[model samples]
Every structure is written in C-alpha cells, then in structure tokens.
Target: AQSVAQPEDQVNVAEGNPLTVKCTYSVSGNPYLFWYVQYPNRGLQFLLKYITGDNLVKGSYGFEAEFNKSQTSFHLKKPSALVSDSALYFCAVRDTKTGFQKLVFGTGTRLLVSP
Candidate 1:
C-alpha cells in the first residue's frame, strides 16, 4: 500500500523567514507526489506535484519542492513565508503501479507564521 508521512504535526516560523514542511512517501512503484494547502474555511489548493523528470518542482505562491528519489522524500520549501501562508499542508501520493489512481494523504501539518 502507498502511504505518505508528515512527521511534524505543526511548524512555526516567523514572517519573512524560510519555511519547510517535510514529507516522505512509500509506494510499490514510481510515485506521483503532490502537496496541497488548505486555508481557514477553504478547500485544499494544489501547491505542486512531482510526476516525473525534474527533481525540483516549483509551485504557486513562491513554494517549491525537491523530489529526492534516493531518500524517498519530497520536502516543500519557500524562500520567505508570510503570515497569510499559515495554513494546513498535506502530502499525498499515488502509486503508478496500480490502475486505480487513488491518492493516499498524510495526517497533515499545520504551519503558523507569526509577525
């Protein structure tokens, strides 16, 4: 079975400082990894994805992720974070080996950015 793990339950950062949300995945085959952010009273928004090819993937709102096949990790990063960036982040994965393209999501990590 495919699974995603987000070790940290919450990440706290000061505004304008760099932030990272760690994610590691396990799958039978090549994995399709994704990151999503959910704001208060809002649905999950697509942040980035790593389907194939590049090791580094960029996404919305100055967010980027590095896909490390060796480590089986895809950690989300930002040069500088804003207070508005505070939200719940999730890591998900889909196993390419299976015909069913169901995504397995992590528990979720809450990010808090303070001024």
Candidate 2:
C-alpha cells in the first residue's frame, strides 16, 4: 500500500516571501510523487512530479519540489509567493505496485498567501 502525509493543515506566507509545503510518503517500491493545487470549486491542477531524474523538479507557477528518497519526502517550494497562489495543495504518490493506476493523496494543506 502507498500513502501520503501532510503534517500541517495550513501554511501562511506573506506575499513575495518564500513558501514551503511539506509532504512525506510510504510505498512498497520506488515512489512516483506529485503535487497538485486546487482552487475553490475547481479541480486539482498538476503542479510538479518526481518520476525519475534529478532530485529537484520544477513545475507550474514558479513552484518546485525536491524528492528525497531517504527521507521519503517531496516538499513543495516557491522562491517568491504570490497572493494568487493561495489555494489548497495536495501531495500524492502513485501506487507503484498498481503500475501507476492509483494515487493516494495526502490530507490537503491550505496555503494562505497574504499581501
């Protein structure tokens, strides 16, 4: 079985400051980690992914995440936060044992970026 954990329920950051949303996972095999954002009443939007390659992966809207195999973590980061970035973020891991058929998502983290 595969699972994800997002310890914080919410993250607050001032506009223009840096931001990070942490995520940890457990899986049977090499994990396929991903980050997604959801605005109010909208579907999940893909942020970034760590399938294979560099430990550091960049994605939409200036967001990035570092995949740490030993730590089993894929933490999302942005150099400069924006008010528009305020949204619900989720960390997900593909159930590799299922051959990428399923994704187990974390209990979302709400990012509150204030101006």
lDDT of each: 0.95, 0.95
C-alpha lDDT of residue 28 in model 1: 84
RMSD of each: 1.0, 0.8
Please, what are the lDDT tens digits per residue for candidate 2 over residues 23-55? Answer: 999988788899999999999999999999999
- Give lDDT for model 1: 0.95
RMSD of 1: 1.0
Stretches of model 1 off by over 4 angstroms after superposition = none
Best candidate, TM-score-wise?
2
**Model 2 lowest lDDT segment of ten:** 94-103
* CA error at residue 16 for candidate 2, angstroms: 0.9
- What would the per-residue lDDT of candidate 1 be over residues 14-61, giving only the tens digit for each residue? 999999999999988788999999999999999999999999999999
